[model samples]
Target: MKRRNFIYLTGVGAAAAMLPAIPVFGKEISPEQALEHIDPAAKKIMSDVALNAARSKGATYTDVRIGRYLNQYVVTREDKVENIVNTESYGIGIRVISNGSWGFAATDKLDKDSIAKAAELAVTIAKENARLLREPVKLAPQKGYGEVSWKAPIEKNTFEVPVKEKVDLLLAVNDAALKGGADYINSILFAVNEQKYFASTDGSYIDQDIHRIWPTFFITKIDKESGKFETRNALSAPTGKGYEYLNARPEDKIQTASGTLYKGRYDMLEDAKQAARQVGEKMKAKSVEPGKYDLVLDPSHLWLTIHESCGHPTELDRVLGYEANYAGTSFLTLDKWESKKFNYGSKEVNITADKTEVGSLGAVGYDDEGVKCGKWDIIKDGILVNYQAIRDQAHILGLNASQGCCYADNWSSVQFQRMANISLQPGKVKLSIADQIKNVEKGIYIVGDGSFSIDQQRYNFQFGGQLYYEIKAGKIVGMLKDVAYQANTQEFWNSCVAICDQSDYRLGGSFFDGKGQPGQVSAVSHGSATTRFNKVNVINTARKI
Candidate 1:
């Protein structure tokens, strides 16, 4: 069979072979098969060698992580195409605990001498810092496991796909948008990742494989008469999948000599054209009068709202003050979780932190610490219920097990608690976006993701979107520009009047979600339905100064 054919067949075959092993409804590999990929003997040897060296040097505890990563990036700007870039990196990092201080070092060379030297340097640094320690460090309790591994579900390997084909496809999308009336179009659809993780300590060992892809496109409309420009973008959420995801996009096409085949490409082009038209209309749009007004937010806009307010504030690290220096702490302190009746929204508001959602950027079978991923609630019935927790943080809060939120961006970085798929549960009623708009006597319909800003506390914020339509007397009049909505976290959630049903819910996320003192970037997703907020304060962008 051809390489592509073999890849496709392997995917199908793996799904069948591992079906019985996976506990989930949809999974491609069994947990055991996933775990078997790691060599237990190698892990044991590495652990013994590293830990013994640390102990001999008078270190208290030690751990090592060996990792390999494969990356590919392809970008296209209008007719200009760039060559696909591929890179491979592998390294091992050693961490040592000595005299109540922690020290770390990493090296790409995996030779025995190099590993030993790295270990020596880590211990030496720990000793040097010991004198500055004010207190002895004590870690939260965790039972050591012998061996473990996890594999994220994927249908194809993005690395196997040709760079020329990827660039061609992206340029085609740009060409289509330009032909559809965009004055200037810039777009990129690229998938760049393959991760191999290995961790070991005095007793525990873990191995994991992760895959990711980020695909995006943007179209801008420029009006020379007014010197004004507006832009719109596709809501293609990054995912923990392969090139198959690009193929699965709602808009994909190829041309043949016979005749023009629709192949769903027309719909994508139509969306782009409509977006451009909206931007053009907005060039002459009047500013929204600053005041409280009933607002209906589309899913494209609502996802980011959820991310800023609910997602960041609910991270246990943020609530506990660990993320204060980088992003500041949250108002939702650990003490207020169970007792606080946070008025997040009406009774319809429900949110969950899950790592199991398919296509989610944060989805994984097991976290970096070898803890199995699972789901939990962040908000229930408009009340603060729980916060995302990793093993150490969970133990600190008197919990027995982790919520599986532990993750490290790279093998060289220390594992920290990170966000998962923080999704807003859809409403019970099957209300459509149009239905929500019809009920509104006067409001604005917001669409697509755009620029946004929020205070450190995740409270006071302003959000802008790709396009806005003016609605009067239960009807969309036309597009509007220079518009933004501002509100406090509590006030905004309290203002939510209604939310659309499951059909309107969609996934959205960021590739570089920063957190921690040293700053680690983790990918996460936010799923939301079209939701309405009452009496939100809208402002004119030009009038802000």
Candidate 2:
């Protein structure tokens, strides 16, 4: 299928899923070849070559990164394997500050001569571009550890798992979906491993091994007589974990009125079966009534809202209008943050931007730059507090150090400010989903993320979900279809009247959150408990369209 058609069918979040064949960014390699590891000492030698070359070329500041990226994908239909892919990319990227401007160059060749040539080229480019600089770039001070290494706490490296095993799992998931009532089903397992080594003019050398996995499927149910159909997508969240994420445990399953929700781990086979059943129910569900009502949003559903509204708006680049060409700028202007009293949400709403949360996609020992990673409050007790900033932008916020949120999708890409794991902190008051639902006289409970659209400014928006259940007189009455909600970002957050406590808190995220001019993707997680918004607008999507 065409790439655009594939993306349209599966949502942009799973950009790599169900493709006939993945575009090879690097050389196609066998799964066994992916297991081979390069010694950190060897990488350090290559990095030193670039660092010295750039300094010799009159670069005031320089950093070198040696990256080895590996990916594996398994795609299956109802009973057959559609595709199996394994690819590897190895390269060195050198960044330099010369003549008060930034320049970068990358080369796939790792030899000392090639590395030095790339470094000198970077410096030359910086000097040529410096003529157009309005002002010299100012970077925040960063104190880095001399030598350090960080690895994901993965129980099993996905590359080590045989391709046959992954194929077996996905085929079984597809079979379960078909057996459960799906007319058509598509399943995929995608795994990524990034081995990165960094060396900078600053006294530091950093080595990091990052791993991520996503297991998902799409199931469709049809009514042959009516020529009507309904679909359900997997509720799994892309996570920065190993294959162990698919090893769902009894405790990982949370039973609720709507259905079973998963936490850190997932059961792909069981979820596919549930999706098959849910799709059939969706086909027969009644259309929702169009009106304002209280809304209870599951974490699986709320994460996208938080990502589009809260996460994007607070990006330092977007706020500064640097992203105006692509995703547009944010409504959360610098002046609002300067006022310090601008209420961004209800008092119960607390949001944080973190890069250190365990199991989060953005979790890292240090950012793409050499700065250490940590967490900071973005919204505190309803007030705007901070924005995600990098080293170059830290001084604008009057901070001495970066928040450690910089990243580049690949070694060939230039590193820039990216969103961290932005999450809504759970309520302090003890509460359960059932208890929270009991207080809502009239509401709709939304589960799983779906189609969403927000203004470029991340203000006004509408969002749809995978499943919608109506609540009446504090009890779930029945399922509802053609459901979506709309509201301004600030107004919606302020209307949050209740949040279930920590026990119900869960994470939902995307493996590909796109940004920048050339369009780079980053993985991020958003955490929240079941939350309630009062008197929000709910629309019947069928009638509105």
Best-fitting candidate, scored by TM-score: 2
* Model 1 misplaced regions, further than 4 Å: 1-48, 55-61, 98-101, 127-146, 202-204, 249-274, 284-286, 543-545
Model 1 RMSD in Å is 10.0
Q: What are the per-residue Cα lDDT tens digits for candidate 1 across 1-545?
A: 01011111111211122111101111133222222343546645665666677778878877777765554555555687633444444567677889888787877666677778888888999988888998765555555666766667777776666666777777777787777666665555545453444444535676666777866656666777865566666655667777776664443432211111122112333444555555556666777766666788765567788988999999888888888888888988766765677666667788999998877888876676656678898889888888988855676566787888877766566677888889888888998777888888878888767779999989899998867777788888776777799998878887877888876667777776877766667788888877888888998887443
Instruction: Give the clashing pairs for model 2.
Output: none
The deviation in Å at residue 153 for candidate 1 is 1.8
Which 10 successive residues of model 2 have the least lDDT summed? 1-10
Alpha-carbon local distance difference test for all models: 0.68, 0.89
Cα TM-score per model: 0.83, 0.96
Task: Give per-model CA RMSD.
Answer: 10.0, 2.9
Q: In angstroms, what RMSD does candidate 2 have relative to the true structure?
A: 2.9
